[model samples]
Target chain A: MTTTTTRTSTAGAASTRRTRSSDTPFVTFEQANRRLKWALLAPALGFVGLMIAFPLVFTINLSLTDAFGAVNAGNSYVGLQNFADALTDTRRFWPAVGRTVTFTLGAVVLETVLGLALAMLMRKAFRGMEIVRTILMVPLLATPVAIGILWMLILDPTNGIANHLLGFVGIPPQEFLGSVSQSLPTLMLIDVWQWTPMMTVLLLAGLTTLPEEPEEAARVDGANAWQRFVHIILPMLRTTILTALVLRGVDALKTFDLIYATKGPGGGSDFEAETLNVYAYGLTFDYQEYGLASAVLVLFTLFIVAIVVVLRRRTERSAS
Target chain B: MTHVLRPRAARGIELSRRSFGVLAATSVLAACAGSPRTASPDAPLRVLAINHVWTQAISRYLPELEERIGRRVSLRMLTADQLTSSFNVKLNASATDIDVMTIRPLQDQMMFARNGWIADLTDRVEGDADYRWTDFQDAPRERSITAGAAVSVPVVTERPALYYRKDLLEEFGGAPRTLDDMLDIALETQRRSEGFFGFVGRGQRAGAVTQWSSFLYSFGGDFTVDGRSGIGTPEAVAAYEFYGRLLHDAGPPGATNMSLEQAMPIFAQGKAAMYVDADAIYSNFLDTSISTVTDTVGFAPFPAGQAGSVPHNIPSWSLAVNEFSLLRDDSWEFLRWASSPEMVARLQSEGIPGARQSVWDDPATLASFPADLAEAMRINAANGVGHDRPEVMQVGRARDIVGRPLVSGIVGEDVASVAADADAEFNDFLVRDNRQQEF
Candidate 1:
């Protein structure tokens, strides 16, 4: 028994000595814990910073220079000239900004409202609900370029299913993609068709997690569905709604694939559907004006961030 | 404790080292085994080709090319625009990968020559007695020089042609010989038919610039004269008006937004009576499977305007050696062989339009293609201008500037004012290009 006790004491003493040798007493357990926490997170934090900050810094640098196409071996620095040029050019940049805003707002607003309605409808259980859910996922899961081509064929003025259906109603063919005036709205509708499902899925998830007590109590108190939804359900879904808004709005702002696939380059022939993203791509690759393209991208980023900020503030106020 | 931990940690590290060594060795062996490239790095002649029809034809004769050059050749083919953009990036990096690349002689290739991006073949051509550099037809051979350097070899000279329906023309009247005559024929034809259009051409902004240039030149105007913007001239305005009036009043309803891709289908399917496009796309018209009116489709020179007919007689694509290439001698051998008279004749026999006097003038070539089409192509080739779009480093930007007004014209906006606005932009373009870039 004495030998056993002595061995336990010695082991404990060795462990204590190790602890003392590894770190000074000045660093308490809490301080060591804080250090361990930081050390654990260092790699992820560093990766995130490098991924986010590196491209941003490089883009800003390119924006400030007079970097042109591939031949810009030196890319002679002409500070802020590109920015000035892009800002003053009422012909291309300003018009592209207007288009970007219009496309984003139209797509996001419609998607959110439609998504909410869809989520509400989908909340109730029904036969083949899983199949319906899977069906809803199809558009979101489709390749964007394939979708664009499919829509192009379906909306073809002379030979398309859309026109064929219209003919049955004794209606004339509509110039959907061909007409410049109609192209933007048509593209917006396409965006809504594709992305509304994403919002529906997100809001559906939010709806599932909501507390049932308030809803039941409201039902017992003789409140109607609309009233309860407006006063309680909506209020509780603030974070979920914001999440959907930011995700959808940001994606809509950066919409390039569908538009590019539908229209060749520089938006359509007349630049009818050109957003700032498309314009920047044209500047960078088509025209080889890298410096000017970078400036446009920078300004576009600012515009997107400003929009998100404004949206967040409005949502916060409404939620409160 | 230190003594115990030391051996364990060392053993772990030693195991890791052995594993890493094995992995590295295995990877090295796999890479060597999997790589299909067998020729010595310096021996393989790297050729970059754009997927133009002419290049597609060239691809068919690669075995013959290898025999003629007496070297192993590796060809990299990319789509037209992708090749162009990638070529610029590759050249900027001074990469020695591509020994030869397909280029345009006058349009954008001159800019490469000015920047010393391509090798000058002047000495090589002048020294070779059998190469016969002068036999590539005067117009195409002359365009081969850029900044006084012979940078490229001609392959195919593409000229715009008016494709018309013989049956439709016979019913309406004889083929229209002039612009005004065409207008009358188109209007009458349109009025008489239910699903037929009088005329159709490209109307997209950028690509339209090339087709639109034929109109501008026929109306006795040009994009520039001695480095001055000529878009505001009365002749240019007249051209725009006539072009716009034809598409809006006589052509199909949606012709305003059509490119050659869309316009050709309507013509081939017998929806439109006529189409004006590059002779390079002749296959699209001649293919029995694609063209319903192939039997009735007849080729003609562009109808005369006030200045008579002028079409783009430029080489749509060319092959040039990269200046930075280590295999310049090998690339030269490929160019010399592929552009040789016998090789060209072989291709011409297969219906590839070779950019040479001998090829177009050969009896076999004329018989191989349509005889009437050959005659017209030969005449247009002899007379067409060297550059359709502005021959400058900033050609794309300049095209966009001049092209916007063309869009406005198609869409029924006041094109005169649009041209005025574009002219101002064009003038600015000239200054910017001169101030900043070289070619």
Candidate 2:
């Protein structure tokens, strides 16, 4: 009994000695600061895991099954059939993908150029600059669906003030929302009007955070104002530009409310305005093709992720 | 490690338990979404209705209906469009927030019935002593069949009739009796009149489809016969050609964009010399807020084509019990009391059309009607057409493919070519939606 107790005490003493020696050299300030930063980041990591990662996993699972309308007993594990079908089907899935690409590309390109102009215009501080910025934020602050409705009323073919003004020019009544050929471009214009302000605000914020020293140096080195802006300010704002593009691109791809409010389900008779998001919505609600919709959503999410990754890489390259 | 993690682990388990409790409670409460079936006589039967002329009927009958049925009743209103696109989908999937649903046969009976979202009210309708199935009109009752079962109780019936300017017809020597006479008037009126459309009709795809269907049906043409597209035939092509010519010569430029909403306003503004649509619009003209040509308007049957005279069938909303409804007993009681002959009389007193044949024959009701309403009801009672595709399953897609493009064609799209386009779409829908099986 005494021998056994002595052996156990010896083992315990050895572990304590090891722990004491490890603690003797205190952590350096830089190391502590690095550890603290990571510690601070832990909560954000946990948040992303819960909000983004968990839902993504759930969505992936939903995509692989034939879960349909009313949540009845007919949900079957259909493997990758839904994904395969979505890639091939013409009724909604493929057309929606085309619409999403067009809308995202169209909206992003226009907003980027328009937003840059607005940002540059406001960059030079003058009288009422604050007031002009405040006015520019109105479209961004307006709810999308509400703005869509407001635009609808203004663009009404018969009763609208737009036609009333057009009549003065002898251009006979034109069907705005009522015409199939014109509806998509009309919706795009409305989207641009509402979201360009948002892009402008973001780019403006980025412009404010940019260092003035590089731009001043370029000006001193015999560069004109336009040349300095093109060579110096544009390169410096690359990260911010990429970030804005990615953020706005994702939202544009998923645009639902404005189109829905304007055209309604099946996207106004011919589905002229249906984006990928709207198509998924119609599948889930109008047709109750839940499995197909889930598949479409899953693939759409992948496309969005690919875009984000490419943008992120570009941002990293620009930083370097 | 154990000492440090013990409290944290304990708290995590407690938090999980609390969250589970909340979730379980929410699930239970959400599952029990509809009203309870077995309510006391003193409690009100929660009723859902559309806000229209129907509301007038409900308001008039509720006090007497409550006393007669020995149950208190209440109502909530929604638009017909709202019921289909948004409300029904939401109500059916989750807890049925509705007990009694007011629906149109076009959407409610067909679409809702197909997905098994609606209840099998056959037993309730057939077994109930107070329902009095024999008292119901044949045309309206026949509309309830979906998948070989009756799913709705029809409230009102509508038939197409001509609303021409009495002054114009008298000035032109007579009203049109057949398709030829109608064409003659159109040609003559356009030649004589300036800045006026001789024949005003909806030319927008959705609206023009209705106009085309009437013409097609009148000429013995149809979308399907023996479960195949009835387009690409001589008679169908001839009908399409006639409609195209009529619109090209007599209808206004840019008529392709015109809809019922646009058509009504134009007709009311005296820009249209003649108009044809459902009988329901007669009341719209009477409404002080809308019409300027109410007094000058005259009524006639839709012009007869070669095979038969086509009357556009505009379906009114019907009352149907939700299958998920727990308040089946109260719902049936309310339906019976509200739809009875006596109740219909009260409704008719306020200009709400009743679905009963008896109400149609009532002398007081007949005497109370304006000449236009009386003429419309007489036509409706004698012969009113329903939808060609009455089956509840995928009829929506079928209607859109067949009807929408036809209407679009009216607005200067090639009528013959577009008719072919519509036919192809119809054939595809019939095959894909399993509509062929129904035939």
Candidate 3:
């Protein structure tokens, strides 16, 4: 009984103190409070500095030197030569960049549009929403290499079920991944099928946490569902959309396992699926051109960072 | 108000501080825990072998190996590509994960030996009274060892030769003995057959390059003369042009992307009249599970080029021990048992080819194999066509240089331009790779 009474009195006293302090302007405890806040944030700031910042600096430094294979013998300090070579080297580098951009853009756009539609459809309760959601997560969690192999078997021109099914509809057979022109697009479809669920889940979370008053108010002001969603809901979800785009863009740029699993070194006979990440890996492991691969990786990292920064800036502006 | 805020901030700080303090304390304590890979000074030595049918053959004799050496033996199976980079990486980084491994003799030897990744097994071979390098044919032994230095023992001998459908040959004016005859036969047969290709070989850069190199070598077009680019000659161009035409007319629809394994099915399904590939495919074709037309198979030497059937000797697989391996003696004991004449006979009876020379002469072994298959092996072994040399170490670059562009051209995309461009690129690679240093 005594402890309860003391706790109530202490809470009352704190509230009273707060009320009194709000009446005063320019409190003198600001400096101490600011110092304490900074001290609390130091660990996370330091962790990011060490793990992310340090390695990036190290990679940049390594990129400047010519180091091949495990042996550091015959290494020459060739500043900016790696960058120049990466830009001009036609056998493996520039083609890789082109592939990277195509893959990222294709995957991001398709996944976003599909994910948005799915999220909207599943917004309300359904008979087996949980089961459907669980089924969607299977592809996301499954290994990319295993998925590549499964797709390879499914897309085999001779005995695949895909062509068999197409035949039933009186459609001529198509060379899916085997065709030079079709491989990248086929991979994009695969990327969308595997990852759209992740985007859907993220958007759904954003939707649930959304304040209802603004949407309800719009509905009352002679607005249809589409009008309210376009004018209010979409604008409100800009930050979440931006987050999804950035995440997907970064991953799609570094897609290695799927391409490697499907096409061996040099990204198939014609190099139809040779993206930047796969190119760098092939250079390092297959060719033992470590210096060249390291240089390519550094350029690729900068390109990804630039993309992320642009997306983040747009996200921040919209959020504000 | 300041006092109230102070309590909340202090609570936050206390919670963080307590968690961080606990983590720091526990990590410091945990640092003194027991280790994972403590060495047993008195423990019996362990041996690891590279994987394949070769490993399967070696595994059979491990009991004999353990009995002889009085130590434990362990074998691992890794694909050809896995064993290559892993062996190199493990040698550089850990120095322990691998003790013994299999490597392709030519490409792996120079890098491995120059980096001191492999020990000089010359001493071991010389010291062992029973060890006989002379027992093997001189050319293969020369290809396996480096500058008279035996670093590893050869496991399996493979050579690339021509394989054809006997039935198809009978239908298409009989077997081709010359390059012109082969081309003529292919052209004539493809005109008559509805869906069947006259000749199906690798048209993919790396795959086709191996097949192309044999023709080039046979036509007296060397890749390097005293370690310089000799691939720019008329003979080389003729060889490249011949294959390009072959791809254009008589090869399969997707022949430009096909490897030997990929082309095998087409031939096995009776869609392809002929294929030129490694001897390992011999078993694959004979296997009842996969092959459809195994009974109609005919093997022959690679048809005569301008210089007459100079078979291109492609090195298959060999086993090498790591420099820092503790079980050097035990590893050799296993290799000896694995490569013995009796064991070779046993493996040969089961349809596995052996690296030993004595197995080649055995009547029983020859009796078990098809007459054509035996004849092809004997000719390849006799000719020294598919041998590995120091110059072949640049095969990776060569595939891109001589191979990739050739493939792009053969696909009818941009034939001459791609070839010229590849020539320029390969020239630069050759100069940069210090390819001239091989001499």
Candidate 4:
């Protein structure tokens, strides 16, 4: 009681001093408090500016120049020439864009669907639920490169266990990642395998937080399990699903490690699995076409932003 | 008690804040001072190198180098791609930390040389008579020079050696000397029904180009002819078609996906009859842990085509002083010591081929290699072309362009049309690349 009284009195004395000093063009307590607030916020704002704003601005500027080979080397302003070149590059750029979209859509859609299913299946209390959840988390915890290598081993056309298992079932051996046509789809499946558990975990958390009254009411009204799930649970889970979609969708769109680890530069012999991320990486590091790479990156960033905006708008509309 | 302790807690926070500010200021001052132009007396000479056999072997004997230089030595090894990326990033910023760099002359030397990332070593290499720059093989020596300046010294030389199963080839009268005979043997022995392939090699577009360069040269097809794209030529088309046919018919399923890593294992596991790749990898076949065909493996020169057998004899890895190095003298000394005749001979005797002609000429080095492999290496080295990929500023891009036809052929697409398309694209690339280089 004495300590609180002493601290309060000290604060009041400080406030009185500030107020008295205000007549002499000195800062008042409000002004001082405002300044202190900004002082504390300045570092975080500066950090955000440095980390996010600077690279973005630098990349945009680089996109306008003919920067090649070395980052510190002399380069001339090429205007929109790099952008024009990238836009016209049917060889690598456009195909990469197509693959990126296809992969993201294929992988994210599959992951969301499967994740939601698994989430619901394990939502209620069940035997060995923790063990199953732990097992599911294993793929999510493993490194992408390690997972890629593991999948490569499992999917090896001639020598893999997958083929051996298929043979036991009297089925023909299939080239999973090795075939050009199959490479992208196989990688998508691998992505789905690695990331579905993440979605499941996220959705399961959302599931537990639900009021359960609506579900219970629907159940008492004698609605079918599928009807309740479709009409009630899914509608209630919109925000979580959209949030998970945005997370997994963006990640899938930028997938590089697994593809690079499995197929390597230019994404295989025919550039079969070259997504935009891989294409941009090849341009910057492998080919040293920094200008083109920056242009591609700028375009890629805009593309991602456009997607997030659309998704955000959809989420808002749904919420409203 | 709380009121009494308040001022003390405030004082403690103020002290911590002041200490942090001082530490930050000190760090800023230290950063501003930067690294010294000349390294401190105790500082280790840093060498950035690829994780190769030569690097592995030299690491064991680094103490000798350190003793000679009277300085500590720090060697860091990374994979080929990682090494290139590291150089690109570090050298671009003009980092002085890397005293010596291991580089691929054909792959990135042009870019590095043009960017002024590697120091010009003409005077050091030529002026030192004892060093005997001429003692290096002609092809690798020629490759080491970029833009008319000796920027690097060849250390590890590579040439493709035909790896074959001696047991499989015994009835076919040993390894084929001619391309046609090799194809015939491959086709006949490819028992896909019995789960064995007749031939296995790199088929991935970019990775295949280097190994295919030997085939291209043997077929009288260079990547360029008179500074123009030559892949459209009949010889180039034939080479592509031949390689495609060999892989498509005799190679294992999913051959298009196989690179050195994937294809080598197939041969090592006794699943393939013949494999053509860099001689540097011969040890993989002899290693008991990986190889099922250890006793059955045979080595031969690249098979003859329209032109006689000609393989790529390249300085697959070379030592160059980083242009921004603070310790150029030490770096050159390290390079000199590493590529010295005695050192080269010693390394070669242990089966890592050195660029020194004298070391290759010495029969003592040959004693360590499998007798047949040494013979094949001797032949291939003598009849080798200087480069394995298209010589251009953007080698990776050029390889991708040049390799498109190879993939088409492997997948049973028409070679001529694909070659024509690739040729046109490559020509356009060459023009653009040349324009970029001029800048």
The per-prediction CA RMSD against the true structure, in angstroms, equals 6.0, 6.9, 7.9, 4.2
User: Model 3 chain A: which ten-residue window has the lowest total lDDT?
Assistant: A1-10
Top of the candidates by lDDT: 4
The digit string of per-residue lDDT tens for model 3 on B396-425 reads: 656756775557656666555666666666
Candidate 4 residues A208-306, lDDT tens each?
A: 888989989999999999999999999999998998999889988889999999999988888899999999999988999999999999999999999
DockQ values of all predictions: 0.21, 0.14, 0.16, 0.35
Please report the candidate that would top DockQ against the real structure.
Answer: 4
The list of candidate 4 runs beyond 4 A from truth reads A1-43, B1-34
Candidate 3 global lDDT: 0.71
Better of 2 and 3 by TM-score: 3
The better candidate by lDDT, 1 or 3, is 1
Better of 2 and 3 by DockQ: 3
After superposing the true interface residues, what Cα RMSD does each candidate give?
Answer: 9.8, 11.7, 9.1, 7.5
Clashes of each: 0, 1, 7, 0
Give per-residue CA lDDT, model 1, range A147-256, as digits (tens).
99889878766445897798799887777877888888999999999999999999999999999999999999999999999998998887889879988999999999
Q: Write the per-residue lDDT of candidate 1 for residues B89-207, one digit (tens) a residue.
A: 78876777888998877556756775567899999887898988888877678788876778888887788888888988986565677888887877777742254678888877787
In angstroms, how far off is B386's CA in candidate 1? 1.5
> What docking grade does candidate 3 earn?
incorrect
- Candidates in descending TM-score order: 4, 1, 3, 2
Better of 2 and 4 by DockQ: 4
User: For candidate 4, what is the lDDT?
Assistant: 0.90
The regions of model 1 sitting more than 4 angstroms off are: A1-55, A307-320, B1-44, B67-72, B114-116, B191-195, B437-439
Q: What digit string (tens of lDDT, one per residue) describes model 2 on residues B128-241?
A: 766687677776787776778778787765666677877887876656878878877877776322447778776654445555666777888776777777765666776767
